[model samples]
Target: MADALTRDGIKYMIARLLENANEAVEESKENKDDAYCAGRKVAYYEMLDILKTELDIRDQDLKEFGLDIDLENKIA
Candidate 1:
């Protein structure tokens, strides 16, 4: 089996995913494209759900790394 992720590693992964999602959201708004925007929105929410569910990282764990469990607030 693959090795478990370190706290730092998990934090980094979550941060990167969030950043990508935020960027996609911003691009969709700026471009004002419907089709691709829909896809980007789906990808962003899917990633957010994975972070909340599949990773199962606790709120305190995120706080320890100066992150927040409130991902919707993090979205741009």
Candidate 2:
């Protein structure tokens, strides 16, 4: 997809994904198959949004989480 996302766009998309995940969790409890899949996908996408935003922020502003960043390259 040539339409690669920008930071602002990713922010909006993440907000929407979080919203959808909230809805999906509720819906999944009452159905089978795709409902759970939809819920998990929403959660995954929302986390992606969070990581992207976090990375874009200046290091001075990032709150310390005590995470071992030296060991991994987290995917967005």
Candidate 3:
């Protein structure tokens, strides 16, 4: 099996991907075709799909990256 990536890495990239998606939307604004707008939307959805599949392969859930899992555990 390949090395397992923690949820943190996944989340970080997801955020970055979202930023990219927003940029794509801005670029799409100039395009007149509804098809281009639809395609741009699909790009974000595709990124989410890739992220989910990668997480499944790594056996990592989003909850695991609570971002402060350690802090929460310590507070408890």
Candidate 4:
């Protein structure tokens, strides 16, 4: 079996997926297909939810490692 994904790996996957989704949206725009564009938008939101979950997991891991920094406030 393959190894399980770490937080960073999950993050990288999410970024790539989002990039693909963006490309799909652009293609749909050029082709003037509303259905395709709508599908891509749905996929984008689903990926966003997955990213949010991964971020929460990472935050938990950080706290476990005694690195309890407020990422939301600190990062931006």
Clashes of 2: 0
Best by lDDT: 1
lDDT of 4 by residue, 1-76 (tens): 9998886675566567656766766666677658767676566656555556565676655343322443233221
Question: By TM-score, highest first, what's the ranking?
Answer: 1, 4, 3, 2
1 versus 2: better lDDT goes to: 1
Over the stretch 1-76, how does candidate 1's per-residue lDDT look in tens digits? Answer: 9989798887787778777887877877787768787588667767777667644454355455434466665552
Candidates, ranked, lDDT:
1, 3, 4, 2
- Which lDDT values do the candidates have, in the order given? 0.68, 0.50, 0.58, 0.56
**Best of the two (1, 2) by TM-score:** 1
Candidate 1 Cα misplacement greater than 4 A, ranges = 1-4, 54-76
Poorest 10 consecutive residues of model 3 by lDDT?
67-76
Write the residue-wise lDDT of candidate 3 on 31-64 in tens digits.
7477877587567757655665665677776454
Taking all chains together, each candidate's TM-score versus the true structure is 0.64, 0.39, 0.48, 0.53
**Residue 74 Cα positional deviation in candidate 3, in Å, after optimal superposition:** 36
Runs in model 2 with CA error above 4 Å? 1-4, 32-76
The lDDT, on a scale of 0 to 1, for candidate 2 is 0.50
Model 2 scores worst on lDDT over the 10 consecutive residues at 67-76
- Weakest 10 consecutive residues of candidate 1 by summed lDDT: 58-67
Q: lDDT per residue, candidate 2, 5-66, as tens digits?
A: 77558557655655665555556555647755655755655564456456646452222332
Where does model 3 exceed 4 Å of error? Answer: 34-37, 49-76
